[model samples]
Target: MTKFLLRWIASAASIYITAALFENVYITGFDAAMLAAVILGIANMIVKPIIVLFTLPINIVTLGLFTLVINGFVLKITAGLVSGFMINGLFTAILASVVLSIVHVVLSGILGVKKD
Candidate 1:
């Protein structure tokens, strides 16, 4: 439970940081950012794997780069689901996804949260 909460907070912080870095990615407030993080985590867990599995051939053809697109798609979905979270374009979403991924990784490492 503690680990889950820690991860949630990490995701929130990642979203906050990513929004701060990108002009096209807009997070209304800290609370909205937190909600967006939670929604993104859920979307990643539930929808991402399915999308990846279906897009496996494309992913392989792209030498795994298409996985980034999948991540962006999920991030866009998250933005749509969260009222205050707005992503301006597909390109921006992809860029924001990359930033979020880096922030999440760095935060997890700094927080001593082991990857599953």
Candidate 2:
């Protein structure tokens, strides 16, 4: 539970970074960014597994690259759920997803999660 919260915060940090660094992404405020993170965490927790299972066949066929699409979907969903998060385009969402992946990896690395 605690670990999950930490990862969620890290994910939001990455989101905030993308908003700060990238022109296309827009977050209204830091609070909005944090809320977006929590929303994303919930979506990943409750929604992503179902999506992964539903897409399992293609995932295997694509060697798991479908996950990028899934991740972007999650971000898109997050945007709709929260008022402050506005992902301008598919490309921006994709870029945000990459930033998210990097942040998750780095934090997970520091926390000593074994990488696959």
- Candidate 2's residue-wise lDDT over 89-113, tens digit each? 8777877888877877886677755
Residue 34 miss distance in model 1 (angstroms): 1.4
Q: Please give the lDDT score at residue 63 for candidate 2.
A: 100
Q: Whose TM-score is greatest here?
A: 1
lDDT of the candidates, in the order given: 0.92, 0.82
Tens-digit lDDT string for candidate 1 (1-116): 88888888899999999999999999889899899988887998999999999999999999999988999999999999999999999989998899899999999999988778
Q: lDDT for model 2, on a 0 to 1 scale?
A: 0.82
Clash list (residue pairs), candidate 2: none
Off by over 4 Å in 2: 1-8, 107-116
What is candidate 1's CA lDDT for residue 103? 92
